[model samples]
Every structure is written in structure tokens, then in C-alpha cells.
Target: MDPDRPLIPAELNRYARPDVLIEKGRLRFLELNISTRLGGDAVARWLADAYIGLCPESGLRRPPSTVAARCEALNRMRHAGNGHGGTGRLLIPIHSVIDVSGARQRRDRIQPVIVAGAQRLGFEVFQADLADLSLDAAGRLLVSDVPLDVVLLRWYGSDRIIDDGGGLAALCAADRAGTVGLFPRPESALVSSKAVLSWLREDCDAGVLGPADRALVRDHIPWTVCLGLDGDPEVERNLLRMAAAERDQLVAKPAVGQSSNEVIFGNQMSAQYWQSAVADAARESPLVLQRRVESGRITMPFRDRESGQRVTTRVPFVLSLFMVDRAAAGVLARHMTPDLPDGDVVIGMRHGARPNAVLLAPAS
Candidate 1:
């Protein structure tokens, strides 16, 4: 560990990290069945087993092959609208973070959210990191190569992600111009960004709170600081004012940052000292100073632990809403430790969620 890096604790240690928590029960496990190290298919197997386990609901485990067969059936849905020359495929490239630097490098440590989600959704989702996405070419992601449907613009941390507007906008353009039907960016960008969240609240400001919104924001979001992980100067100055005026309990985050990494607040921050760091963070993109919430998430289509049946249940809580475009897609109710500033990223993988537990936008 570098001496100059922010002081890290055992949990924060990138080397060891929060236990991978692979297999908790006879059925619950994370590591792909080593017996089949087949390409992307290994990941596909996990989803199949997960879903098959859901189908039984009698606490019976599933054979790995059963899950793979179910997952392969997802190809058509992945290309629904675009299959008939609608749009080639939504191209959600991830090249912006290649050379950018600021937040702690935890990309390797971060779990593969997109890959897993794709697996569960049963799509053979293609992946391209910063370098693969960087090459400027028309065929960067050729339409003929694979069956593509929606483009999932993904990233690990908030530091570099919020500022990737160019990349996202490009994706948006590709979806509209090409053969893709959707381009939903990462949850961190669509929900966590203060700027975007503020906009959504204002738009959905129908003069009253939905029953779910009221339940979620009970007691003004029970959070202390606004963690701004952006680097734009303008965004930084605004953060200083928010800390000075509106939001006193605030944190300074790099524009390109990871959650809880570089988060400085309370006694650690000086109204003046943070302004410089806030200014540094602002250069990248607009950072936000927001009231925190005890957030948690439960992915839909979860399987029951005891029965191995498809039933939704709550897992790790990371407060982030799920969406496709501006319309509300699905709101996650994640459970976090009561006393921590952070939460787990991938908490559960179960069958579709219950109707009322979440707020989902209408089908697109």
C-alpha cells in the first residue's frame, strides 16, 4: 500500500477485501463450477443454475447444465426490437476510464455486475473494457458478429463514471441511430449522481410522494454528508457552498471516483481544505453534496434459499434506483449495515421481485 494513499482499513484493503462470500449454504455459492471453465459460458451456467433452483422451490439444487440451457434461450429477447433492422445493437462503450486517474483502482476487485445481470436476464452480453472500447472504428462493435439488443453502459466506481458523458451520449446516439432499443447507463450514473437525482425528483414532483418514496425517504434520508466524487471546478465551488450553506455534513469525492474512496467529511474536512479538493474533483464533472440514506437493494427474479425456488428476497443494501432511460424501471431496496457509509454492490441474485416492494416504470 502506498503511504500517500488515503488511510485504509482491513475492509478497505483491495488486496484481501470484504470476503467474497462464495458459498454460504449447500446451494448458495459464487465461484463458477470449476468443472466447466468454458468461456463466457461459465458465467452463463451460474445464471441457469440460479434460475433452475428457483423453479424447483422445493429446496432442491439444480444441475449446472440445466441452468445453461435456460440462459441460452434469452437470445431473442436481447434483440427483440432491433432484430428486424431496427437498430444494429446499442453500443455502450467503456473507453473513457482507460487513462483517467484519481480514485482507487478497484476495477479488478469490483464484481462483474453487468455480466451477472446479463446472465440472469439470460443474454449473452458482450463486454469491452476501456481499451477495447477506445479504438475509434466503425466496426468497434460490429452488428453482424453477435446478436445484440440493449447496450448496458457500465462502470465500477463513481469517480470516473459520472464524467463519462461523452461515452454515454455516444451510446444514446448509437441506440437511436443503430439497431438497439435501449441504452441504460449504470445505476451509479443515473441514480447516484446528485445532479441527475435532483432532476428526477423535480420531474417526478407531482406535489406528493408515492407510498414507496415516503417509505424510502423516512426521516430525510438519515445520512450525514454529501459525497461528491467529481472534479469540475464549478461543481467543486458549488459543493463548497452546499457544505457551507445547504448541506453542512458533506464529503469531497473525485469526479472519477469509487464509492467511499476519497470520501472526507466531518472533522476531517475544513470548509477551506475541501474546497481545494472539491475544486480538484470538480474539474472532471459536476460533483454533488447530498444527504445520505440508509440504502439497500434487492435484484428481481431471486431464488428462495431453502426451497431453491424463484422467490424475491432482500440481500445487501446499496441505495440505488434501477431504471431504463428517464422512466423509473425498478427501485432497489438494499439492506446496508446500520452504521457504515458504504454498502455491498452485488447483494443477492434471486427470482423476479414482488410487485409492490419496488417502483418500476412501464414496459418500453
Candidate 2:
């Protein structure tokens, strides 16, 4: 389903990489990243050898790299609307001053890995902040004096991208002149909305999906609804009824948001607090309430270098799939404390948690 409007206004639409949840042998579609920028390639590169060595007996294999596909996607976008293509000089833009929120603070941690991976895949890669990006007199996008053929934008979200007016203007100018490419065409942001899950559920309920599709939807898609946005009395009444009735079974999320910011799991709060949260969510951004599903745990090996010992622990984790050029590229496993079943590994990384590259093997 198309969003009412694009998250960031633009001319083209492409792919959206979504975050999904699996519980009790079922898949649950979660929110999406319009930018679709996961530092997976970098992480996989960092962990590839170590993981393979550690799991040699398990027949662990390297997950496919996304560098080539991403480069090609940008190249395709560069030539799609305008007949312009060349040896891709890709520039990845990151925030110079890290946000106070402490999410994706510096590309320094991930940029070098991406650079190495991209270089291996045969692309000229550069990293810069908005301050260093500009449009030259001839309308070419330049990063620190070097003209960029494609930009692998990691500005975080579409909202953040829109707020970078000067940089966005320069980028847009370059795009208009067919001098540069954007990995994700801005219109693709439309697919990132959690609202789409509701539409999918509606279609499922309406019997629009055939048996195979209906089974997939029923097994994977949670019951999600956009509440209090329209201010219709009947809609609001029904929302409150369902929300109150299933307080412990619900999870509330911002309709258009990222980084798991301000997500409220109903089971964790009091009835009074949940009501207030639902009210406040409606007042700010339209909110979606989905049935919460508990995630299972996985056994992971952790080695203590100082002690020169290895131990295995069962940790709660969420598996994320990375896609490039519309194909499965790799898998990422984020471990979290068992207490916080829905905890975000990215957020946990700030405090200290390591992300793992998942090697998928057939069932024995």
C-alpha cells in the first residue's frame, strides 16, 4: 500500500528494507528503514573470518555482501530518469555532530568497514558530512572537492534528511542535473510507514489474499491499527475498546518513526500509564498498536580474551535479513538481555553489546 504521501518528497520509488520479528515459529513484520542503511556489510566483513573459525564444525558460511547490489541500485537510479551513467564515485554522508539521542553517533565506527567492503566490490568510496557536501557551478555534487557519482546516504531517517535543507538542496540540484545518484530514491520512503501493515491486515481480513498468502499473513503479520489520527468518534471508541481490552497484549509505536524511539510495550506499564501514552501518541504522531509477540532465545558463544576461556549462553535475539538489488544479501543477529525481550540491539550497542553476523545453513 502506498502512503498518503512520500516520507521525503521526490520523483522515484524503489526498494524499502523492513525490520521483521519472529516469535513462536512465525514472522511478524515490523517498522521499515526508508534509507535501508544497515551497517551489515561492514559488520559481516568484521566478523566473517572469526565467525567461520568459531563455527567450523557447524559449517557456517559467509553471508552474501551487499556492496555490488547497492552500487548498482544507485547507478540504476542515476540513469533511470536521466540518461547519465559513469564509473561510480560513491559518497556516504553522515552527521558530523552526533545527535544528543546517541543513535548512530559517528560513521567512523562503520564507515571504514563499508569503505573497505565497497572498494573490494570495485567502487570509489568517500565519506563526508553535510557541511562538506556541495553543488558545484556545473551542478555536480562534490564531497570535499571530489565529484560524487552516487551518494550512499546514512543520514538516519527521511525526517532527518528533510531537515538538512542546504545539503538536500545541493543533492537535489545534482540529481536534477543527472550528475549524482541516491541509493534510495526519496519516494521509496513512502513504504517505511508502519501504517502499511494495517493495510495488509485489512486485505487479509477481506479475503483478498489466496490460501498461501492468507496463511503467510496470518502467521507473520500482527493485528495492527492506526489509531486516533482521524479523530472520528467511532474509530476512537473502537480503538480504546480494543486497547483497553488487550492492554497486556499490545505494543504501541509511532506511525512514522525509527530507531525504536518512544515505543511502548503495554505489558510493561500500568493501565493508567498506557492510557496516557496512547493519548499523548495520538496528539503527537499517529500511533499504531500491534499485538506483542515474545521472542525466543538462541545459544551463542562468548569468549573472554583476558581469561582465555569460552562459554556459551542462551541469549534473546532478533534476526534481521539484509537485501540488495531485491535479493537476500545477508543476515544479522542482535543479542539482548532476556529481561528486555523487545530491547533494541543498536541502542544496547551504545551501552555495550556486540552484533553478530549470522551464517544461514540448512536444517540438519
Q: Evaluate all candidate structures by whole-model CA lDDT and list the values in order.
A: 0.37, 0.66
Q: Residue pairs in steric clash, candidate 2?
A: none
Model 1 Cα lDDT, one tens digit per residue, 62-108: 22232233223233335455534423333334444432455444333
Where's the lowest-lDDT run of ten residues in candidate 2? 1-10
lDDT of 2 by residue, 71-180 (tens): 55665654563334556677777654435365434444454556775676567877666666788788888887877777776643433332343776787778777677
Clashes per candidate, residues 3 or more apart or on different chains: 48, 0
TM-score: model 2 vs. ground truth: 0.77
Give candidate 1's error at residue 301 in angstroms.
30
Output candidate 2 Cα RMSD: 4.8
